[model samples]
Target: MSTTVWIILAGALVTYLTRIGGDLVLSRFERIHPRVEAALNAVPAAVLTTLVAPVATTGGVAEAASLVVAGVMYLRGGGLMTGFVAGAVVLVALRNLVG
Candidate 1:
């Protein structure tokens, strides 16, 4: 097999193992501890910040405004999906306005 094929197979195997390992670990616990629960809850927000912070700082007003709307929606008790929709709608509207 070529190097590219080997790399692809290795990547797939690693990804599969990661998913399985997470499931196995969580399943073994009858009830997660409060601290663990808190850590788990923080993961999504941390990931979101890392993913969005760069583009949000560098992008145009539409991007910045969309992030603000999404953040506010989330803080106001909207679901993640709702926040995503709010951000996307704002971004699209602003893009059209700017264009």
Candidate 2:
């Protein structure tokens, strides 16, 4: 097989194993410990931060502006859906204005 095909197969194998391993590990714990449960709950915020931090810092004006707006909305007690909608609207308006 070609090197590219081998690489793709390896990646797919690794991805599949990752998903299966996560399920197995979680299933082994019948009752999660408090600290572990809290950490697991924080995973969403951590993932979101990882995903958005780069865009907020180095993205285009519209992206950065929208991230800031969304953050403000979230801090100001807006729910996730509200923050997302407000940020999307800001991004769309900025994109239209700039383009």
Candidate 3:
């Protein structure tokens, strides 16, 4: 097989194993510790926050401003979708204005 084909096969195998491994492990385990369960449940939120923190904190002027606007929208009872849309709009508008 070509290099690209090998790489694609490897990626597919990895993905399949990851999905199957989670199911197999969870099915085998009758009970998990409360702390472990809590940590597992919090993993998604922690990952998302980690991914967004840098963009929200250490970006250019436009990004920083948009982060602030998004944060305010979130604080004012706006949902995740609303905050994301507001931030995107702010970023795009500011980029255009600056350019």
* Estimated TM-score for each candidate: 0.62, 0.68, 0.81
- Candidate 3: 10-residue stretch with minimal lDDT: 52-61
Error of 2 at 46 (Å): 1.4
Better of 1 and 2 by TM-score: 2
Clashes of each: 0, 0, 0
lDDT string for model 3 (1-99, tens) is 899999999999999999799778878878998997998899899988999897677778899889889989998999999998998999999989985
lDDT of 2: 0.90
For all candidates in order, the CA lDDT equals 0.92, 0.90, 0.89
Better of 1 and 2 by lDDT: 1
Best by TM-score: 3
C-alpha RMSD in Å of predicted model 3 compared with the true structure = 1.9
Count of clashing pairs, candidate 2: 0
Error of 2 at 13 (Å): 1.1
lDDT of 2 by residue, 1-99 (tens): 999999999999999999799778989988999999899899888988898787678779899889889989989998999989999999999999995
Question: Looking at candidate 3, what is the lDDT of residue 82?
Answer: 96
lDDT of 1 at 2: 100
- In model 1, the clashing pairs are none
- Candidate 3 off by > 4 Å: none
Ranking by TM-score: 3, 2, 1
What lDDT would candidate 3 get against the real structure?
0.89
